[model samples]
Target: MTLPDPGKSYAQKRDALEHYFDRTAADAWRALTSDEKVSKIRATVRAGRDDMRAAILATLGDDLSGAQLLDAGCGTGALAVAAAERGAAVTAIDVSPTMIEIARERTAMAVPAGATAGPGEIAFSAGDMSAAPDGPFTHVVAMDSLIHYELPDIIEALSAWAPRVTGSIVFTIAPGTPMLMAMHAVGGLFPRGDRAPAIAPVPPARLLKAIAATPALKDFTPGRTLRVSRGFYKSQLMELVKR
Candidate 1:
């Protein structure tokens, strides 16, 4: 797959994603913040995502206090809100307006009353990470979202944010192994398949090359590889530091 141009403005890319999510925006929101039964169903559908986020945070080490984080493509604000709970100031952005709205609502509901707050805050926005706002963040994350675009686009998007990071970037993508390719083929053949978008893993080498192409990025290291049931594909996580 070829990556989209990095030159496109964040707003433009966001508009495209918003258009796609418009059809199911309301349903997505409802599922995210639904009652116990509905939320459980949603969780089952997104089980892999929950696992991936947990793994990413684990790779980041235990000390997350007072860190500023940028969560790109923060669907329903899962990772963003979790980070805030851990005492990190988080700015979560997504291309889908509905997703952002749902995430904001969830964030509000999750915060405890009369709790001593730190520098942590969960802020949601409708923006694209491909061209995110400038930041000097402690950590930048894009989980299960970069696979939508090709390698070049992923590189450009992550690179733009990498330079502004004083700490590290933790990202996850579906690998393009034989199993993953076969799964994608099946999904294409049968749209009703349980697998969802960005779930089919891409090749780790491709991701590494993308990072290498960006002179501003280095220390590309592979993290854990986890098999997610939804996509039936093994997801690879990686961490990179700006050189």
Candidate 2:
């Protein structure tokens, strides 16, 4: 029998990862306790996924109470759960059904029984982030997922989604830093299994330009460049008001 093509099937990636999480969430949680290793991971391009979410939240500032949040490309519902924990009503969406399933399961596991109040409610679904349904969210977050699309595509996607946000849109992109370039070059030479889609790093300036060009968005601003390990993975935080 022919094996499945992993590259085209997001479901395959989701299934494999869900199984990994089911078998190892406890071990993964334990492994996260090593502060030295966590620090190293935070410094490199391959930063731990949760670290990216924390950084994004830090950038978002306080005053998130009762705000509507969207966790775009929410894998396993980490940021969604975090936002909900912060008392923001959250809707988490991913392209893979299996991923959404795992996210729901994880969210349920995190909530304590008989607790009257904790985090806000989290609704998980499978959908394309680039063309998500209309919801006037106070904040929209996309992390690590933009690397899969080219810069123009990323800009187009962001432009389409920007108007839906009433407050801010925060996202991280793999910067074209020297260390990251070198890593890319080495990876290109070795050719890993079936390469995942990753476009050239979208500079903060280019992202700004795209935001400016979009008709529905205003008040475009660039935020800090976050150093994720050896590579400088820049995250441009854009605040847009509907026009």
Candidate 3:
């Protein structure tokens, strides 16, 4: 609920996401993040996401000792835990309280029962990621978070954090390919209760253009970018680092 005043469109998208993740989709989301057997499409999504997480973490370099990170929209805390295990203090935030609860359980199980010193500590919070506290963060990763928002909202979200981040801002967007755009259209035709939030496809070229035009983000320039396409999941990862 820690939402800074967002524009109407952003607020609407945020509220829908909160409701869907917190209530309608909690169990299904948990299953997706776990090792449980799932449909072929869901399995592909899981694989794509796994690969995306590794690629994103790799971009931050192998060792994260003494680093501070923000895992915005950190569903299930997989990436957050991995970063912490590498010795980074991580702040993991998600809109779903259910997701935060699962993240806590997973984190406890990750470190040994009575270790002298655990890997860098993780502080979990259930709130709007746009409201994440200002930090001189070494890194910030927002995997699969902004796909549902329009370009302007995406820009706003990035702008809000760019000033606070000292390292990189890495995030994923649904590629504006015909297949995905058609999928988005078909998804919207489903019963309102049965649909996930609509992912607004964004072309990589357009995103780069927007970044260049944004003044608050003038200090940042494109870094490593990757596209992970495994079955149904088609997300493009983009990284921004200070000039």
Best by lDDT: 3
Over the stretch 22-120, how does candidate 1's per-residue lDDT look in tens digits?
Answer: 443446545544454433335554565667778887866566787878888887877777788777877677787777767767666333422323456
lDDT of 2 by residue, 112-222 (tens): 322222238777766677666677788788876665455666676677777788777777776564445445444331123322233346666776777777665555455
What tens digits encode model 3's per-residue C-alpha lDDT throughout 1-243?
222222448877788888878877788888889899877767888999999999998999889997879899998999998888888878878888889888878766333322222348787888899888777788889999998877898899999889889889999999866567556344332233456666788888998999899999999989999999987678999999987
Using all chains and alpha carbons, the TM-scores for the candidates as numbered come to: 0.75, 0.67, 0.89
Greater-TM-score candidate between 1 and 3: 3
**Could you give me the TM-score of model 2 versus the true structure?**
0.67
Output the worst ten-in-a-row residue range by lDDT, candidate 1: 189-198
Alpha-carbon shift of residue 76 in model 2 (angstroms): 1.3
Model 2 Cα displacement at 213 (Å)?
A: 2.9
Model 3 has a clash total of 0
In model 3, the Cα lDDT at residue 155 comes to: 92
Relative to the unseen true structure, what is the C-alpha lDDT of residue 17 in candidate 1, on a scale of 0 to 100?
52
Candidate 2, after superposition: displacement of residue 31 in Å? 11
